[model samples]
Target: MNKYLTLLLLAAVMISCSKPSDIIEQRTFTVSLDTVQVDSKDEILFLNYFLGVSTLDPSQKFLYNLNVRENILEKINLETLSLDTLIQLEREGPNGIGSPFKIIALENGGFVFSNNYTLRYMDANRQVTKQTTLTREPYITDLLPSGKSLSVQSNGISNDGRYLAGLYETSEMSDKPEGIVWFDLENNTGKLIQTQALDFIRENNLTLELEGQIRGGFSTAVFFEPSQDKILFSPTSRNMLMIYDLAADSLITKKYDSKLTSNEQKPGEAKTITDLNEFDKLREDLLKEVTFGEWELDSKTGYRWRFSKELDRTIGEDSLIFKTVVTAIDENFELLGEAQLPQDFVFPYSFWIRDGMPYVFLNIDDELAFVRLKPNFGND
Candidate 1:
C-alpha cells in the first residue's frame, strides 16, 4: 500500500513538472500610424527623452507628455502635436527644481515630478501646486528612512488620483527588502505598502552583478485598476503578475502557465540572450559599446525595451543609433504578440488601451506615429 501511495505521488509530481499546453488565444495586432509632426517653431529641439504620457481627460482623445531637455519641462500635446514650455527648473530658489528625476502623470491632466527627492505636483498650467518632502513611515519590515537617498525607479498614480505609488531602491546596495510606497496626495501622508524579502534571491535564482542585484531587470511596473482599489504589477525579469488589494492589504500572485520563451527572434531560432547567463555575456560585450533605453508598455499589451549601440562606423564622432523590441503578453503571461521595431522608430514609446485594444505611440523621425494591435491572424 505504501509503494502504491509513493507511485501515485510520483505520478502527480511528474504531471506537475510537464509543460503546460493550454495558452490564451494567440492574436496578431495590425500596426499602423496616426502621424503627428512637431514643428521647429515649437522650440522643442527633440523628442529624444520621453518622461511619460497621460490623457488627463476621460475622453482619451488627447495625450500629454512631460518631456525634459537639460532640466526644462516641456508639455507636448499629442492631439494637436504642439509643444509648450511650462517650467524651466533652477538650481536654488522657491521654484528651484534641482535636477528633475522622474515624472508622474495624474488623472486630471496634471503631473508630479521628483527634483532631488522632493515630490512636486503641478497643475494643468504647469505651475507648482504642491510640494512634499519624502519621508519614512513604519508599515513595511525593516523600514529605513530613505531620505534623499531613495532611488525611485518607476512610479504610477492610482486611477482614482488619490494615491501615488513609488517603487524604491536604495543606493546603499545592501541586502534589504525591495519596497514600494503609496502616498496619499491629499493628506500628504504615505505608507510603505509592499515589500519583498531578499531571501527570495536564492529561490528565484536572481543573478547578482558585482556587489548588488541588477535593479533595472527586476524593477516593477505598477498599474492600478480603473475602478477598483487594487494595484496590478509585474517585475521586469519574469512572466508573473501580482495584484495588491489595497483595502484588505493582501497580495495575490498570478503565474501563467506558458511554454513561450523571451526571445525576440522567431520560434526555434538561437536567441541572442535568452536567459541570465547570456544576458551577462551581452553585458560584458556591450559594457563600453551600448546603453539601454527605456521600457515602455501599455495595459494588457506588452512592452518595448530599447537600447542604443555605438556603431563602429561613425556618422561623425561617437554617434549612437537606437534599437528596440516590443513584446506583448496577455494577463496569463502568454505571448500574445511581438514586433522587432524598425531602427528609424523613436525612443521612449507610449502605449494605452482604448475600447479593449492596445495602441502604441512612436516618433518616426519628423512625424509621430501610432501603432494599434489587431486580433488573431490565421493561426500563425
Candidate 2:
C-alpha cells in the first residue's frame, strides 16, 4: 500500500476506537411561570389544604383533587382557572369510603379510593361497586399484639390500571423481602418480590439512616412506568431511588448526589427538631393553618410536593413548596442523569408532569401561578 494511504487508515482506526466524552447531555432548565386568579370562594375553599392533582384526559386541561379534610373531590378547569365540584363522598355507613386517604378516577367514570387498609371502587352514582382488602399476610410473619399492625400505604396505580403498588413494612429485617408489593388488579392477587436496589445498598455497605430508622419514611413519590414495566419509589429523606422491574421480576436501586434546591439551609442533612413540645407550641403561636403534602407521578418524571416547615425569611411567608425533579434512566433503572428545580422558584404551589414537561400550580397571594420548565439540552 502507498505510505499516505497506510497513515490515513491508521488515523481512521484510532479515531473509531477513541471514546467520546459527550454521550449524555447535562443541561439545566430555567423556569417560566404564568399566574392566574381564582374566585374568592375557590381560594377560600382550598387555602392551606390542597390534596393532590391529576388530569382527566391526556390533554391535561382539567385537573382534579380529592380534598384533604373534606369528603369532596374537586376539579379545576385549567383554561378558566376555576374550581368546581366533581363528587361529594360519604365518610360513613355501608356505602361510605371510610376516612379516605387517596382517590383516583377511572376512565369509565368509576373511581377508586383507599381508606387505610381497604380499597373500594365506587361507581358513577357514588355507590360502592367492589372492594379489596390489603393484608399483611405472607409479608409479615411475626404476629404483633392485638393493637399493633403492619404499616401499608397505597402508592401508585399503573397508567393502564393493571397493577397497584405500595410500600409495606415487615415486622423484622430478618424477613429480607423488599418492603414493596404490586397487586395485580385483574387477578386480584398480590406478590412481593425482593428488589435488587436494596441488595445493592447492602452490598455496597451504605448507610441510609433517616428519621430515626433505616430508610424509615415512605417515599413521597411512587411512580409506575407502563412503558418500562417498572415501579419507582422515591423517599423524601433519602438520596436513593428504588425501582421494581416487573418484566425482569427484580428490584434495583439508584442513588443520586445532592442537587435539589430546598429552602432549608442544609440541602441533604436531617434537621433536628430539638424540642417537640416547643415546636408544636411555636406552630400554634405563629401558624394559622398547616397542610401536609404528598407526591404523584405519571411516568419517569414527577413533582415532589411539600410545604414550608416554617416561613421562609427571604420569601417572608409560609407557602406551599412544590417543585419539579426529573430522573433520566435506562430501561434497567440505572440512573443516567437528573435535573433540579430552579433555586429561585416561587412558592405555594402544586405540579404534575405531562409529555416531558412540568405543569406547576402555584398560589401566591391568593392567585394561582402556572410555571413550566422547557427542556434546552446542552451537550457535554
Candidate 3:
C-alpha cells in the first residue's frame, strides 16, 4: 500500500511538470494614424522618416540617426540626409553630437538636431556645415536652466522658411516661474537663443498652468508639439498641454486634463527597441519567475504574481512602454478617459516626433515608437 501511494504521487508530479503553459499576453492596441499618401519622391520612408521632437520647429526638419547601440548619436546628415561617422555639433568647438534631441530635413539638403552641448547641422556633403554653441553653464541633472545657462528644449522655422523660432530652455528660479525662452535660428551663428518665454507669452499671452501636482513624471511615451516650431508640450502625469508660441514668444498652456477623456498612452507611435543585451536580460528574469508555477493576472495591479513575488518590474527599467488614449476633453482641467497601461509598465526614457505630421515618438529604454493621429483621425 505504501509503494502504491508513492507511485501515485510520482505520477502526479510528472503530469504537473508536463502541463501545457498558460498564455502570456501582451497589451494589444488597435492603433490608428492619420496617414497621408507617402510622397513618391521620398524613397526612404522607413529609413529616414524619424521626426525629431522639438517644441518649436517642424519645417526645421532634418534627417539624423542614432547609433543606438552605444546610446550615442551615430550619424547626423548635415547635408544630403545621409550618414557619416562624424559627430555633429550644435555649438562652438568640435563637440560630438551625442544625444539627438531633434533632427529634420533642410530644404537645401541637410539636417539638424540638438546634442547635449550643441545645435549641430549638416550640409549636402554630410559634413559639419554649422555648429551653434550651447551654454553649459550649470550642467546638472533635472535640467537646472538659469538665466546664463540657455536651456534649449524646442524651436520652429517660419512659414517662408526664412527664420527659425521656438522655446529656449530657462529657469527663473530667481524670478516668476522661470518661463520659456525664445531664440533666433536663421542666423543662429551663436550658441543659444537670446529670446525669453515672457516675450512669446506676452505676445499671444496664452496662460498655462505652471504649477501642478506630480510635476515631472516619466514621459511614458512621447510628449508632442504641433510642429517643431511650436513650443507645445503635454503632461503625461498631469492633464495639460504646454504650448510655447515663438511669434508670441509665449507659452499657450492648454490643459488636456480639463474635462476630457485623457488616457495615458505611449507618447509616440512606435520606436525601435535598440538595446539587445538589456532585452535579453529581461527575458531571462521573466523565464525564471515563470518556472516557479502558473501565475495569475490581477487587474487591480496588472501583474501576474504570487504573494511571494518580490521582483519589481518597473516599466522603463524593466518592461516596455506605457500606452493610453486621449479620448475627449471639456472646459475645465478635468481629464476623462479610461487609461490603459501595460502591466508593470512605469514610464519612458526618451522621446521623438515626426515632421509635418501629427506624430510623436514614444521611447522606452529598449523599445521605441511613434504616436500619431489615426489615418482616419476624426473620421469616426
Candidate 4:
C-alpha cells in the first residue's frame, strides 16, 4: 500500500474507535431562573391546588390544563401568560368523557383525554370524535398476566396521535409496573413488550403496609420522545433508563454512574408501621435519600436532561434542604456533565423543555406562574 494511503486508513480507524467523551467536549451549564406570572384577566385560574395534567402545545405558544374539578379545559397563552379560553366539557350526554384525568394536546388542534378506562379523542370544537376503552380490548387482556391490568392513567399518546404507550401494573393495588404496552390507535392493534431491565423497579420498591393497606412506593417516569419516535422509562429508585424504539420495536437499557450523588437508592426493609408518626418519618427519610426526577429531552441539542435530588441538610423543625442536580447525557446515553442547582432553587411540580430550555411550573400565591431555566453551556 502507498505510505499516504496507509497513514489515512490508520487515522480513520482511530477516529472510529473514539468514545463519545472524546468526540464531544464536556460542557458545564449555569442555570438562571426567570419567573413569568400569568395574567388571569380578573378571573380566578383553577390550578387544582397542585400539579395537574397539563401540556404545552406543539408550537409552544399555548398551555392547556384539564380542570378536573370543573370538567373544563383552560387554555393559557404562553407568550402572554394570559388565560385565553375555558372550554366546558360534558359529564353526561352523547359527548361526555366522564371525568378525564389525563390530557394531551394534538398538533392539529385536537385533544386526547383519558379517564379511568376510556380514551376519548376530541376535536378543537370539544366534540368527541372517537373513544377507546382498554377494558374492552381483547388484545390488552391477553397481553397482561392472569392478575395484572392495564393502567390507562399511565398511558400517553404519540405526537402524531397515531399510537398510545403505557405500562401494565402487577395488580390494581400495586405500584409496581411490569411491562410496556404499545397500542396503535388507528389500526386497533397492540403489542406488549417485557424485559428484565424493569426488574429493578419491581424488586427495589419500598412498600409499607398498615392494616392490610399498602403505602410508600415509587413509580416510573414515562416520557414520549416524539422526535425519535420512542418511549423512555425512568424508574425513580435508580439511575437507569429504558428506551423503547417505536420504529425498530426494540427495548434498550442504559445504566449510569453518577459522581454528584448515589447511582441508586437503597431502601430499608419494608415493615408494618403501627403508628402514623413512624410511617411519616420513614416516608420522609426515603424521600431524603437520593432519587431521580423527571427526564427531559432537548431536541435542539439532542441532549437528555435528568434531574435528581438528595438531602443537603435539615433546617429547624420540619424544614428539609435538598440538593438538586441536573445531568446531561448525549444521544448515545453518555453522561456529559452534571450541574448542582443553587440551594434556594424551588423544586418544580412539573417541567417541559421548549427550544432546548426547561420551563418548570410554579404557583405564585393563587396565580399561575412558570420559572424558565436559562442554561449557559460552557467550559467554565
Candidate 5:
C-alpha cells in the first residue's frame, strides 16, 4: 500500500511538471509592413520620445505627443497620417503644467501630464482641472526614510478617471522602482502596493559609474489595461510579466519559456570606469542580452503583444541594430505566437495595436512615419 501511495505521488509530480509542455503549443505568424508618413509643416521634435494614442477616441485615430523642447502637445491623426493640432503649454502660471515630461490620454478626452514630481490633469479646453503633488502625499512620504521622496510617473489611469496608477522611484538616480501607488483622484487618497516581484529589477540592473556619477541602467515599466483593470509591471532585464489586478488587489507573476530566445537574461555586474570609451564598450556588451518590452493588449483580438530584442553584434554599436522578435499571448496568458521582425525594422519606443494590427514609430529621413505590421496568425 505504501509503494502504491509513493507511485501515485510520483505520478502527480510528473503530471504537474509536464503540464506546461503539453498545454503550451508553439505558433507561427507571418508579418507584412506598411509605412505611413506624417505630413507636417515643421519637423516634429522628439516624436518618438514620449507619446500616446487617445483612449477617448473609440476608433484610436488620434496620437497625442508631447514636444518637451517646445512644450507643445501635437495631436496627429493616425487614420489620415496628418498633424491635426498643436497646443502650446505654458511653463508657469494658472494653466501651467510645469515641465511635463510624460503625457497620458484620459478617457474623457482630457490629458494627464507628469513632470516626475507632480501629476496635473488638463481638460479638453487646456485648463488644469486637477493636480496632485507626490511629495505632499502622506501615504507616499511616510513610506520613505528621512530625506528621501518619491519620484512619480503617470504609468496608468483608470477608465473612469477615478484612479491613477503611479510607478515611483526612491530617488532621481535610483534605477530600482520601490512599488506602485494607486491614487483615488476624486477622493485624494492613495494606497501603496509593494511586492517581491519587482525585486528582479534591482537584482538584474547593470550600473555604470564614472567620476562618482551613475551613468546607465535599465528601469521598470508599467502598462495599464483599462478594460480589465490590470496593471502589468515589466522589468527590462527579465522575461517575467507581473500583473496587478485592481479589482482583486492581487498580483500575479507569469514566466514563460521561449522556444526562440532565452527565458531570462543573466544579471549584470556594476562597474566603475574612468574612460568614456570603456563605458561605451560595457554598455554595448550589456545591450547584447535579451531585454523585454512592455506588454500591449489588443482590444480587437483580446491578445497581448510584447517585443523582445538582442543586439545584432554583426552591426557596429554606432549603427545599433537588434534582432527583434514579437511574441503574442492570448487572454488566458498562454503563449499564442511569435515572429521575428524584418531586419529593416528598428525597435520603437512608441508602438500600439489598432484593430489587431501593430504600428511602430518610424523616422523616414527626418520626416515622421509609422510602420504598420499586419500579422497573419495561420490558424486564425
Candidate 6:
C-alpha cells in the first residue's frame, strides 16, 4: 500500500464516522421531513422529535394544487390518508417557539393539536372553531378519552361539542393536584373537577411533604377512552398511564413499568419486569367500545390489542393493532426481537390491546414505516 493511499483512506474513514446524524440505515424508509420553511400566512405541521408532519392553509380552499407550494398541512399525496384542513384558528407553532408535535384528524372530520402553547380546536376550513390554553409549555402528549386520540390535542370539544379538555400544570414542587379542570367548548366554559393520582409521589419518586404533594407539572396531553367519557394521559418523563374519568369527574393513577429500549435502560433491565397491567386496563376499556376484544402483554413484546367492535367511532384501532406488533412479536405470550434501537429511532406513542398486540412508531430511525403484525405460537 502506498503511503499516499493509506493517508487518504484513513481520512475518509474518519470523516464518514464523524457525525452521528449522518449515520444511515438502509432498512428504514420513514419520511424524513426537511422543515419546509413557514411564513406569516402559511402553517407547517411537522414532527418535533421525529413527530409526524403536515401543512395546511386557508388559500388551499380557494385554489386547487395537488403540488404544494408555500403551504404546510397540504402535503399528503403518497396515499389516501386524508390531509386535514385546520380552519378558524390563527397560525401558530409548537410550544410557540418551534413547531408543535404531530397532528391528527378527529372522528367528526376536524383536526386536533396543542400549539405547544395552548390547545386548539379547528374546523376543516382552516378556522379557529374553538381554542383554549391547555398548558403553559412542554405540553403533555395526550388524546381525547374517546374519539380520535392523536398524540396532540385541541383545548375544546366534547361529544356534544360542549365540553373541552385543557392542559394544566403546576411546579413539580407545587401541591399535588386536588382538582382537575377542562375548557368547555359547547357553551365556552372552563370547568375544574377534583381528582387524584394513584400514589402520586411513590410512582413519581418525588417528595410529597405533609404540606402538599408536589406535582411535576401539568401536561396538556391526556388520553381519552373510546367512549369519550374517560381519558388516558401521561405526565412528563413517565410511561405510566393516568386514567381521568371526565363524566364521573374523578381521576385514577396507574403506573406501568416504563418501556425502555435496551439502549435507554441500564444493563439487565429487559430481564427485569416491565409493567403490563395498565395495558390490561386499557384493553378492558377499549373492549367496552369494540366488544369481545382481546389483549395479551409480554415484557419484551410490550402490549397488545385487537378490536372486535364492528364500527362505533373508527379511531383506527385496527390500524394500530397490526402496527404495534410489526416492530416485535410474541408467541403464546413469549417475547421476540431486540429492543435496542438506532440512535435516531425516536419512540412514538404506543399502547396494547389485551387479545390483540403491541404497536409503536419508531421515528428515531430516519424514515417512518408503519409495522403491521401477526404472531406465532410460543413453545412450538
Best by TM-score: 4
Candidate 6 C-alpha lDDT tens digits along 136-192: 222222422322222233132333333445443343322333334454434443444
Per-candidate TM-score against the hidden true structure: 0.56, 0.60, 0.39, 0.81, 0.78, 0.39
Tell me the TM-score of model 2: 0.60
Model 1 lDDT-worst window of ten: 1-10
Listed per candidate, the RMSD to the true structure in angstroms reads: 12.7, 12.0, 19.2, 9.0, 9.7, 19.0
Candidate 3's displacement at residue 2, Å, is 54
Report the lDDT tens digits of candidate 5 across residue range 88-161: 88868878878765566766777877766677888988899988777777765775556544444326555455
| lDDT per residue (tens digit) for residues 1-380 in model 4 | 00110000000112343566555333344556677788988877777745467877878788888777777778899777799998888877778867776677888898887765888888878788988888877776776788777764456666556777777776533345677777776777777777655544543333456677765444334444322367776767788777888789787888877776788778444344556677677677777878787666675677777778888888997888898777767787766667676676655546777766677777678888776766665433
The per-residue C-alpha lDDT of model 2 at residue 14 equals 21
Q: Which stretches of candidate 5 lie over 4 Å from their true place?
A: 1-29, 41-58, 143-180, 204-230, 246-249, 270-277, 315-321, 378-380
Q: For candidate 3, what's the RMSD?
A: 19.2
Question: Model 4, which residues run further than 4 Å from truth?
Answer: 1-25, 151-156, 172-178, 204-229, 246-250, 267-278, 299-301, 378-380
Error of 4 at 70 (Å): 1.8
Weakest lDDT window of 10 consecutive positions for candidate 6: 2-11
Q: Which is superior by TM-score, 5 or 6?
A: 5
lDDT winner among the candidates? 4
- Give the range where candidate 5 is weakest over 10 consecutive residues by summed lDDT: 1-10
Model 5 root-mean-square deviation: 9.7
Taking the tens digit of each residue's C-alpha lDDT, what string does model 1 give over 209-294? Answer: 53344443332233332124655555433344566767788878754332222311111211222366765654443333322233
